[model samples]
Target: MTFESPSASGLTRRGMLTGAAAIGAGSVGLATAPAAAAPLTARGYRTRVVLAGTAGGPPPQDGRLGICTVVLVEDRAYLVDLGPGAVTAYARAGLTMEQVQSVFITHLHSDHLAEVYNLFWLNYGAPGARGNISRSVGIYGPGPAGSVPQAPGAPVQQPEAPTPGLTDFLRGAVAATAYDLNTRMAESRKPDIWNVLDPHDIELPDIGASATNRAPDMEPFEVMDDGFVRVTAILVDHPPVFPSFAYRFDTADGSVVVSGDTAPSDNLVRLARGADLLVHEVYDHAYFATINPRLAETFSRTHTASDRVGQLASAAGVGTLALSHLVPAGVRDVPDQVWKRHARKSFGGTVVVGRDGDTIGIGGRTK
Candidate 1:
């Protein structure tokens, strides 16, 4: 039951060296490593998770983009969330949108969903998306909040249907772009928008989950089961945002859990238990408190701190802990080494301080 600890160079477990390789000119490990030394490819691993965009929050950071993660199994790509710069990052990582089979949204947060529509609208019928021209890309996300959670000074917009789900969101996206979509369909050779993106609201089983008690302790439930992979979901503790989820992707090769946005929760640990990799969100309490005390207080309750991530990873018994969705994501704001040091304090497994395009190979050779 013993696990090999990470080396200073990279994460090594039982002779498995998870790449932690950066696709940009950034440090790949605790020590200085060559930039882009390992290009992203499906050759080495049976499954891999690419950190498409690492920065957290709505405002743009200096080097990193917003939060988006891609779990790749062979040629098929399953995306967890699509943030502002995810589409472009997908191309930059030498991957085409055609490779994407399904897209999962953790919550309806603007930072996590800003570019979701753009992902399909811009790419469909384009040269890169030729392969899936006839196939509909599945979009799965939380259903509508049963009732809006109360908050001070927060006026409800769209009072008729205060909270909309994935289906409604996609409907709005198409409506907002109706002019463009119609024009392209008539003038340009764009295919029917409906045929390109298929949206679904995930049906939550009766689990006593509500806007007030957002994340109740429960076993992971099956979300989707494509022939190649089985996806399961568990509610995580990101309050005021009901139905926020952490997802686990299991393939024949291995499993990885994407902790969408949450404070440390046992539900997450249970969902990610014994998975080969745990990709989790992290915030720096000290740094954010100095910048904005009010926002820091909110983050402290909703997101996991860097120092506490390892404890969750250890509790989950994940092989490696890859930190993404970083708050205060600027390279100058908080260095990678700081994240590594903090995470290492509580867990013995490998900890990867994720950069925008870093790809970590799992259950196979390190790239």
Candidate 2:
């Protein structure tokens, strides 16, 4: 796989000092620029993966944004997960909202879906983006979980429909922003939102899955096939967030898998098997273990550590492993080298610690 950061202007002394000051100030500096021709070339490859946000969880971190990724097939963009600031990051990556053909959500976590509405609402009619959405863009995600999971003896919040699916979430967004949508329709005569955006709830086959048995071992099933790419999903172990998924996109160029928040799940390994690129999430076990032991323990059960991610990639025989959705995403708290070191301990293939806008290309004439 070929890797490049779109805004890698090379370390300037001023930029170095600025980064240092931001780290000292305990603030994340996640500024990115539009794509350049050199980065987009991809050595003649047709398929590429762009890391929009690398930070995991809700709280913003230093040097990293939330978790979002874009898979590019020629000019079309298929997005996976729209975390905080993802809409802006998508634009910063030189991707026009008009190029968005489909969106796949891994789960309903706030950090993962924070900007789901913003992506569409903001891009619907921006300058140079108006009247361009002729085809419906499909947004797919897990359906509502039948039941909610809570800690033993803990009371469940929003017991009724505790887990809203993608369709329900989109409907709620429309309702919550009814005033604005209505005003735009009356004044600007904008196209109906439903006419452009198609939201769907991914249906699951009978595989003995449940709120408790979140990810029973199963085969990766088809979620979509839009001629350009064939998308498949499998249950991944992110407990309490039932129906959590890991998606794989198979294109003529090659295959790329996005392991949404998960532990070292066999289901993920299966979904990613033999893929060219596995963009996986990772946690800093050492950092979490020191700051919050209980939370670290909980994360260990819900997330895969750096070494475990490496093992999973190795087991899947993926050509490359790109690590994103970092738990402690701060450069000061968990440096890139630290993440690389832990992952390399278990896997021998290429390990890429992705930053926002970093592009990984597969197949074609490799660089």
Candidate 3:
């Protein structure tokens, strides 16, 4: 998005730092005391996954593929993805976009990255009341892959293309929005409009973007500070869409993993081993089997089926399974009994079908 001129009442670095400090202190109810210094491992961290856009295709419930948008709340806020409805979901979940410190993209799928531009614009142009923060938000994602685009109906193969890699696409998109961002901010009086700090001031990097340098194996890569908790990503196989990832977050009290969008794979099981929770995408096999044949075919080509998800969760010994990125099946389509029958056959642990605003606490502490 485009950038607006700096605010007339531009906040200085010192003022911004002071404001951040105050917010940090107040959030934890330690505003009046000398900063209680503690190692990252000692301080508790929390995570909230918001189902931004449930429906994937056209609006009015065609299908929901609003890929994952997880919020990692620690000393600072880190967002995992920016699905279509993530902005609204964040607000519904009582989170202000302004407080988000960074955004980590899993892939370049439209459903996954559709909200990136909106998020950037919202933070940089919207009024203050809509969760706009001035802090520079970091954006991270995988780099490009060398591949030729196949014609429609051609046999699908490894390394699909036509869509520039995440790095190139984001760079161009952000660069193009510069003018629009500036114009909107200048026209709006809301505090949200002031949230967009200069894009030049923000750090946007394509982590593991290049195929050669990309960590293709299922190993977790630490993304942020390790003081209170450590966050890492593991490569998972989602073929024809190489370089997909599943992320794990470990805190002192507990650990959690976010299985972005992948078919059942051993990579996920290994990554999730010993985690307290696994937030994974699940598709109802029976429901899809009986629905529109075309849609079912598309589903198979892209995501994991429900039974597979159950098996993966079971094998990993995950403590809890929070099913997200649900398919078109509504309550009637996949009744409780059907879900229980399939899920219980594999995962004996607690299995929750996540809703838009559902909150599952990883550690035993209340935030």
RMSD of 2: 5.3
Ranking by lDDT: 2, 1, 3
Residue 172 alpha-carbon offset, candidate 3, angstroms: 2.5
TM-score: which is higher, 1 or 2?
Answer: 2
Better of 1 and 3 by lDDT: 1
Q: Write the per-residue lDDT of candidate 3 for residues 1-367, one digit (tens) a residue.
A: 0001111132334324433564311211111111121111112335433433343332334323355455445434556666766665555444555566667776666666777667766555334554456555656665554554356888754444544666566566757776765565477543332244322111223454433333344455576553755767766655556456777777766777888777677778888998888878767766767867776776775677776777888899987776766665343456545655666678888776654444444554443
Whole-model lDDT, model 2: 0.80
TM-score of each: 0.88, 0.90, 0.72
TM-score of 1: 0.88
Off by over 4 Å in 3: 1-65, 72-76, 152-163, 185-217, 294-298, 329-332
- Tell me which of candidates 1 and 3 scores higher on TM-score: 1
Give candidate 2's error at residue 40 in angstroms. 4.5
Best by TM-score: 2
Q: Candidate 3: global Cα-lDDT?
A: 0.56
lDDT of each: 0.79, 0.80, 0.56
Which 10-residue window of candidate 3 scores lowest in summed lDDT? 26-35
Worst 10 residues of 1 by lDDT: 29-38
Cα RMSD, model 3: 12.1
Clashes of 1: 0
